[model samples]
Target chain A: MNTILSRFQIEYKPFRLDIELEFPNEGVTVIFGRSGSGKTTLLRCLAGLERSSTGYLRFGDQVWQDESQNKFVPVHNRPIGMVFQDARLFPHLTVRSNLNYGYRRIPPEHRKITFEQVVELMGLRPLLDRRPQRLSGGEQQRVAIGRALLTNPQLLLMDEPLASLDAQRKQEILPFLIRLRQEMKLPIVYVTHSLNEVLQLVDYLVLLEKGRNVASGPANAVMSRLDWPGKDWPSTFGAILTTTVADHETEFGLTRVQYRDQSLYIPEQPLAVGSPLRVHLLAQDISIALGKPETPTSVLNTLPATVLEIGPTDTPGSSVDLKLDVGEPILATITRKSLAHLQLKPGMRVYANVKAVKMVHEIEEY
Target chain B: MDPSIFDWQPVWITLKLAATTVSVLLLIGTPVAWWLAHTGSRARVWVEAVVALPLVLPPTVLGFYLLIALGANGVIGGPFQSVTGSSLAFSFAGLVIASTLYSLPFVVQPLQGAFEASGKTYLEAAWSLRASKWDAFLSVASPMAVRGYLTAIVLGFAHTLGEFGVVLMVGGNIPGKTKVVSIAIYDHVEALEYSHAHWLSGGLLLLSFMVLLIVYAFNRRLPVHLS
Candidate 1:
């Protein structure tokens, strides 16, 4: 697949953002960082909401912005969609007209999605006649998403769309977001600070620190890197495993998932067998053993794994991270003493013991 | 009080002046208010102060300056008279020009308030949705500012209807062309025709009160911002 290349250099007083990256023009590419780390600014630069004096942005064959040639595309002219943190719906228009606001503006030939498709995709049928204030926070966001999607944009940029919702509201809207990722073909560049959101939706990851790109790669690879600054590392220091539901042990109240040849037992999930799921394994939740354990173990998940890399601990004498390949790269944080006791090294086989209670059930499918 | 005691010509002239002034104000005030609501330029403050000058200055003071500006020999009236053989002072057109200037702030301030309260968030959202700048203003900003329009129109019309000193100085009591209701009512009181003064004054008081009542009642139903 071709890549979208973006280069930007922006300076506003005390902050300067300089980044250059190439990412696949498919799936969700999450820009993850702390609050003041320039994630929103980068999204604005791409959307042409904020013009960076020195920037170059290109997707496929088109150049959206090129400062050297003095080329620029205004926000209305760009074939892109943006969902803000606030829903920002037109108050005077009903839900139906709000969705139609963009659909009617684009030329008929340029529209890729129909109004009916958007209404169905966002589940906005029931609220069509109502005003925006009549809907809840989650419902308003869904309409905002539908309104953006109806524009037939080549790319979708979301700036913390879930940030304004309460926990219950977040839960209400998350499935629709997952459906958007799974069902839509348009590439999405999502900006968020929540690790949970990144784990669920991110396919490619870019880690930004102090307005600069510190790391960028596959989601799992960047999440397991131990050398990242400690402040922003622990939140994302986890392994992401792509597994499929193999069996439902209704009698034992467990769902058996398969990653390659190994099986992992988790709390019984409502998903059907053969459904794809991505499981997040935090490094702190994983413990290592030299050999496979005997029966009668309290931990329900134990898989054979190989150590891929051993790196220094962030805190002195606290713990070191062992990058393990358990079908996929899984991170394990063990003390220096345990590291020496196990005589662990690259390519050495070990047992990765994960407590069933620590396994999070938050799963997203591609 | 005999019905024959009232002429009604001044009442007709006042309504015509108020209607024409309000129409012209809407045509010009909408853009000026929109600009005031959106502009960050330093000159906005100066323009705003000029628009609001009539609100604080005495009506006769404003009338005096307008008298000079609209006289046959003055800047505006001199050129107008040279092009057309009629002098602006003591003419119906002179009354409209004076009333529009006097009621400028009434039309602009409310609309400016409405536009400011609506903010740029919705317009930006419209722009992202592929609405051009003009389309966004018409479809989004204009409809959202309906309350402001109502307030501006009512206030500008009512203020023009009740104008006294400015009309007296500029229009100067020409019987049919420039003698408005306020000047006629003054003539009645000065001539000791108490019944004639009572009838016109009572009608104006009730009309002004009802106009304000309707505006306030309608404004209560529409919020400043949609959500």
Candidate 2:
């Protein structure tokens, strides 16, 4: 598979970024970080917008920048598209013309993404003739994404495209973003500070802090580590399980999803049976039970989970995290007192009551 | 009061000077303004000061320097005289140069302010979309700065139309060639032709106000900056 290899070192006075890595050119590789962690700066460097960065950068087979041989492709010459935090639409042009700004410049032989495809994907059909200022913030961002897609770039870089939008607007645009990721199968290097975005969109994850890479790997592996910058993990920590809709109990307003060989009930979802769904269950949300509760408890889903491992997390000294083999590896956190009281240990069989599960808005490719 | 006594040559010369000055300023000012707006170099402050020198300096001071610079033996005028065997001082070309220099700030500052205000995000967006530098400027920067261009043109034209000290110093009142509306009005006042001076002076006043009014009105209708 084609991959992007890069080694970059940049300095902004007191802070410096020194990193070297290679990632496959597939799926969304999210650079997750906090504010001022040099996330945007790193994305800018990938786009050739940060000239001060010195090192070698190879996108697939193309040498975008190689300082050793004095080779550099300017931002305009690179086969990449970028969507900034704010929708930087050309104010003077109507939506159609703004979308066509880059489209008109590309040679026909190089046009891989069609205008019709982008317009449909971004839901921009209705706002074609309108000016950018007339559109709502969400509509403006949609056009920005569409404009970038119409370029048919080899790589797409997004720098907090949804950062400026309110939560509702973010929800409105995320579905379209997921569609692009699915339908186009485009390689995207996305930068975002929101953990919600990570839960919703990330495939490969790179964690950053103070301009340095903390950890990076497949999203699940990195997340399972439960280490975050300035975040209380194992509490905010969760597992993303790729499951299929098993069935729906309409009378009880619940949907059953099959994870591994076990099925769990979540609040009713509008999804077809046997379709794929991503279930996000927080470590804190699952409680341990010595046996399957004979009574119909308020907790709906109970699974007989085997304790795979038990360990005290380094950050939070009071709680112990349990890795359970519930047909799938799921993490559960409980206080140290509870662990002793229940005598929870590896190789022990126990029932787990799943208190909450969130259905994130994107399908997962497992 | 006598319509026949009024020579329209000065009116034509004034219009010609304003149009020529505006065109020249636009051509040269755009790149300079763009550079000022985007460059991080230490030379920016110095270049800005030189461009805005006319705004602070008296017109006659600018004219006095241009007088020497465009004279027969001066640096620029010396080369031209050797080739064409003619002088630039007191000619229409001399007035054009003086007017352009005087209105340099008017043209450049507005465009630079607009370019700086809108910032680099949009331009970077265009470039990432594969637009060349010139392509991005023409399609994105220039169009977004429409108000800046409008203000620059009107201010440059009007400021040149009201030219007096610089033209008087560099361009001697040669009828049908160097004589302009301001110089014509000055001549009427000196000759005690109060009525002739009144018509010309009032015309310029009203004309400047109308042009400025139109610009302000149009600008008010436009968004201060496109979001």
Candidate 3:
């Protein structure tokens, strides 16, 4: 697979960052970390906003920075668009002119996206004549995104674009972001701390802590790993499955989703049959059983599975997580007593019962 | 004395001098102020102090130094005189040079403050949008610093218009050439021509007040986000 490689080392007075990683040149790559974890700093380095003395970055065939060669492309010369946390729209220019600011800079023959298309995609047509201050926070961010898109950049870097908004405003802007993700082919490197955002938007994940990358891979694969740092382990320890709506039972108020060869039942969703959906199954919500139950079980779904791995839980001495391969990796936490009772071991055939399933609804398109 | 009998030559010369000085200051001070606002070099403190020197020094002290610098025997004036076969001292060109130096801080300080307040955030945004450094400054920084430009123009022009010591020292009382309103008023008061002094002084007072009033009022109507 084609990928972008980055290697950076930064030493400021109180902070030092050293990371080297590669991510696919398509889909959303989330640089996920808590505040002060240097996620934003990493994005800045990629954008050429913060220069590191010892750094090398190459995106596909283009070389952005190579300190040893004394080659550093200035920020303006890079074909990358950036959306800052504050939306950083020019206050002196109207929203129309602000969008035009970047659009007019690129030569016309090289431009890929038109002004009208960007305005339509960002829902900024109504706000064209208004100045930035006159728009709401969500509106300003939409304009910021439109301005970036109109630049026809090969890559877009968004540094916590929703960090400054209130919860309601975030809700207001999330749909637009999802549309951008779905409609545009531009590769985006998004830095966010919101778990909801990660689950909904991230395809590739890079976990950063204390200026270092601890893990980086496909979002679902990295999230299912039990060895992630303790602080983020609980929040990120879940499995993500992409399923499609197979059928709906209106009388029973159930939506049957097809995952691999098995059918999983969820609460009735207002979606057309055959539409794709993402399901997040938390490890703590699953249970294991030695044999299939007779009938009339309260648990909504059950599947035959084989134990893939057994690892100690984040909270030691109490429970262990059984990574079961029910066609895909599904995690189930059980007590030491249950583990011994079932004689659970890797490669052991068993039945896995899911007590609950959460449909990640934000990513669904109407 | 009748108003018609008052010499209007000084008024015209003062206006001309102030306009020319302000134009030159804008051209030179803009880049200096921009550099001062964005630079982190060790020499920034020294440069800032030098720009502010004229603000604290007495006008007569600055006039004394300018007189030596522009005189035919001094470094700058010697080469200028030899090249042109004309003395720089006691000339309108000498006054322009002196006034530009005397009013340097008036232009630079406001611009520096504006540029600093405009901040790097917007410039970075512009850069990420493919704006070259010069393009970003012209389209984003300059427009946002409109208040600073206005303040600089008004202060520089008014301050040069009221000049006495610097002009007197460099351009010694040449009518229709270097005899500006301030120096002419001084000459009238020294000669006990009290009515002429009062008329020119009153006219200057009204002009300065009106210029400031217009700026303040127009500034209030500008969008607050620009500030």
lDDT of 1 by residue, A30-127 (tens): 99888888999999888888888888988778888999999988899988899999999888889999999999999999877999898888899999
Q: Identify the leading candidate in terms of DockQ.
A: 3
Residues A1-366 of candidate 2 have per-residue lDDT tens digits of 398887889998888888776887889999988787888888888899986446788998889889988888999999888899988988778999999988888899888888888898999999999989899888999999999988888899998998898878887898888778778878999998776764656788887778877778877666655333334222335577777899999999999999878788888988799867777877888899999888778887777889988865465478877888676667888888899899887999998888887776332311
- Candidate 1 residue lDDT tens string, B1-227: 87885789999999999999999999999999999999989999999999999999999999998899999998999999999989998889999999999999999999999899888988888989998899999999999999889989999999999999999999999998899989889999999998899999998999999999988888888844542
lDDT string for model 3 (A1-366, tens) is 478898999887588889998999999999988787889999999999999898998989888899999999999999998999999999888999999999899999978899988888888889999989999999999999999999999999999999898878887787788778888998999998765655667889898988899889888777777666636535336687778899999899999999888889988887689877677787877888888888778887777889988887456577887787876676777797888887888999888788877765343221
| Angstrom error at residue A168, model 2 | 1.6
Q: Model 2 scores what on Cα lDDT? A: 0.85
Clashes of each: 0, 0, 0
Poorest lDDT segment (10 consecutive residues) of candidate 1 chain B: B218-227
TM-score of 1: 0.94
TM-score of each: 0.94, 0.92, 0.94
lDDT value, residue A19 of candidate 3: 92
Considering just the first chain, candidate 3 attains a TM-score of 0.90
Which run of 10 residues does model 3 chain A get worst, by summed lDDT? A357-366
C-alpha lDDT of all candidate models, in order: 0.87, 0.85, 0.87
- The better-scoring model by DockQ among 2 and 3 is 3
lDDT tens per residue, model 2, B155-205: 999999987999999998899889999999999999999999998989889
User: For all the models shown, what interface RMSD does each have?
Assistant: 1.6, 1.7, 1.1
Query: How well does candidate 2 score on lDDT at residue B194?
Result: 92
